[model samples]
Target: MNLFADMRAVVISALDQMVADGALPEGLDFANVAVEPPRDAAHGDMATNAAMVLAKPAKLKPRDIADALASKLMDDARVALADVAGPGFLNLRLETGVWAGVVQAALEQGSGFGRSDMGAGRKVNVEYVSANPTGPLHVGHTRGAVFGDALASLLDYAGYDVTREYYINDGGAQVDVLARSVYLRYLEAHGQEVAFEDGTYPGDYLVAVGEALKDKVGDAYVDTGEQVWLEEVRDFSTDAMMDLIRADLAALGVEMDVFYSEKSLYGTGQIEAAIADLKGKDLIYRGTLEPPKGKVPEDWEPREQMLFRSTAHGDDVDRPIQKSDGAWTYFAPDIAYHYDKISRGFDELIDVFGADHGGYVKRMKAAVSALSDGRVPVDIKLTQLVRLFKDCAPFKMSKRAGTFVTLRDVVDLVGSDVTRFVMLTRKQDAPLDFDFTKVLEQSKDNPVFYVQYAHARVCSVLRKAQAEGWDMSDAALAQVDVSGNTHEAELKLAAKLAEWPRLVEIAARTNEPHRIAFYLYELAGELHALWNRGNELPELRFMQDTAEASAPKIALARATAIVISAGLGILGVAPAEEMR
Candidate 1:
């Protein structure tokens, strides 16, 4: 059903015919030959670089190869013309029936229209939103959550077996700090006034956790020192915080298939085993790291420590796995976690991290490479900061002011669909501006609203057609004769619809879910444009005065809706039937 792929096959067959006829040399590699939408739509329906790529390899002139390829290509019923231009680019104008066939295919496939089997069912583990289990997720984690969830869905649509995962950072020193913070809250619950100092969390979110602890064990650690309550309180508080985080993610429509605990890597022999696997390959050693360039820490002193030879695999230098005090460094657990992922037999691994973790990307990749012996590839995507604005001014959140925006706050303001869609409107590696005023605006400038409006518009068309006694069921729509619809605007929409399956494959291959958001915007733009064109041109209108004509035209409009719904489904956004 992919028109471009179909046309590419025709182009390849023609090239093979040329080789047989002695119009071109034998055994020219066609891997670089690509058939894609022409840069200018006015040029043609599709364009191929076959002549240009094979000219030098075949020792033939560009125009000569293009002429021979064009003649052979024109023999296909689908191809109307294959014109050579600019040294060997072959621009093709496909028959109107080809575009109509695309619309018919969309209507026939329904939600499965754009599903691709490019991944061949490879297992992929996507770990994201692994924020420190110290507090409720904030705005920073929101972007990662949305991006990761959408990516998992996108890969699934592209036929990858995806596992959405969250790695809890409970084994770090930050959890101990959370423990002390909850102890203060516990004292407050016992009617004792306590001030939150420099090292403890002061957010009111933990107030309930403190009260719950008191309820569970009344007066047990009333005035005890850190020794008696630290360990127990740490475990209790981390569980509470993780609950809060899980609720926050649920509010944003994110559900993880697994919640991996960092603490689990500590008591088990997992860390030792992971490092031992690397050591067997001579990748682990006691080494001194060079001081970071440009701005060294004031306490800069070289120390020999247990390190991973990350430089052997693409990192800038070997990274420390253990501190001088014979304790595991932060990198140790992460390495062990990835090793665990590799052991789980995933064919590939993807990690979505915040932009601040950019420095850790290389080392993590190195660890996975060493663990899997380069058998599996790890792709780390960094989601940059999201700047919020209100009243056309920058909105700042301050932890000290007790006004920091949580993920719940954003979802509550705009709902999960808007929040998720808006978060993905920008590339993960690029900074995004989430303007409260702009996102909710009903105009076409708002992508979420615009895409939703296209779906809703299609619903309006169906309702109108049904009220007029025109059969508009899925089965009836699939039987419509789209052959009568040949308007340039209508064909343009069908052409855009043809790109959906290709878009899914590209987005999944690049491990980018933002591309789906971008593609949806473009598709919505085409749909809206065609709808607007109908206002000016009577022939382009969907609802005809007669049932026979209306069924065919409205069928195309319904086909647009089908593709939009499929695309939105991949983004995990519910397609709107009507927009308020």
Candidate 2:
């Protein structure tokens, strides 16, 4: 099904035959030998470095090896022409029948055409959008949510057992701040005047939580001290905020398999257990710390503290695990969380964080490395900021969120499909400018619209064929003789379809789902180009003089739609049957 892989095998088989016939030496490692598309399409359909890589190792001239290999390759039915390019690289032109087979495979497989088994079922835990449960998710978290969810889907398609997770930052000073803020709202609900001071939240979203608290407890905790209501309200308010966050994520089509609470690590001996495991390895120590590189503070002095020898595992410096007063530091709980994940027997781990957390990546990876003793691998991806523009100017912040635009604000304005697709239009590590006016524009300049329009066009073609009383189902179109689809545009589109499986494997291997977005856009361009060509040449049209004659052209259009739907599915965007 993967023509690139199939051709690579053919090349390797020919080289083995060369070794047997004494044209090449025995025991040359073919691991680095690669077969890929030629850099310039004018050169040929495929190119291989088999001759170049083997020349030096085989103690033979590059040109001499290439000549012999070309002769052996021409014997195969798939290779129509094989010739040496430059010094020794072999460029190949596959038979036209090869493209026909690719089109048939796409029709036969439908959306499953590019699914790969490269992961071999390894368990991968993907933790993303672990924003503190202080309020509804904002635009920054939305990018992380979309990126993480799409990555989980891509890994699943590549055969990894992926679990989507969210780590709640509840056991922190931030939650206490949220409780006090909600208490002010609660007092307001009781008809009492209260001011949201500098340290409290003033967002209008918490107004309902305050009113709901009044209904639950009546006047029980009215005018009570912090000792009486802080704990109870903290739990109550955290639950409410999480409900809001969950609803926000649901609006964007993101669902987590697990919502891990940081509070559970405390009073549970988990932090101590993680540290104990490190202690057993002599990585924990009581040592003096050095001053920071810049101008030292006037109150600064060298002090001994409990630290983890993080540098032993790849961190820049030894990190403190506990304060001088013996309370656990912020990094301790994170280490414990990852230790718990390692104990859960996951084979790999991935973390999706906002760009501001770039400095935190090294230490987190070091913690997992030290915890798993290099038995498992962890990759951390950081999503950069999103700048929103509306009406050709900077968009205003949401009054409901108080300081920033919430996830629902973006989704409500442009819809979940547009929001999701546009968020991934740029790389996670690169900043993205999302223009409201431009994204919704019905033109080729808009990537999401371009891709969706291609799918809709295919649907339109199928409908027209069906109304003409032709059988246009996948089973029937798959059986069509597509050898007659020899037009330059038709063959070019089919060649692009042949790249899907290879592209999926590359994107999955690099943990970059944005590549999928880029590929979908390019694939859509091919379909659009071919569709436009049909207008110039009547013979290139999908609907021909007869139904039987129209079968091949319709089959090509249907195959393009199948691949688009599959790519969009991975991105969590529903394909459009018809665009308004």
| Top candidate when judged by lDDT against the true structure | 2
Please give the lDDT score for candidate 2.
0.93
Model 2, 468-545: lDDT tens digits are: 999999999999999999888898889889989988988999999999999999899999999899999889988898
lDDT of 1 at 364: 90
Which parts of model 2 have CA positions greater than 4 angstroms off? 59-61
- Tens digit of lDDT per residue, candidate 1, span 1-580? 7677777888888988888988887878999898998999999988999888888989989889898889988899988999999888889998888877888888888888888888899999999999999888889899999999999999999899999999999998899999999999999999999999867988898889999999999999998888999999999999999998999998988999999999999978999998899899999899888899999999999999998999999999899999999999989988899999998999999999999999999999888988998999999999999899986799775552154678888888889999999999989999999999999999988999999999999999898987887788878888888887888788888888888887888898898888988988998999899889989998888887888878888888888899888878877799999988
TM-score of each: 0.97, 0.98
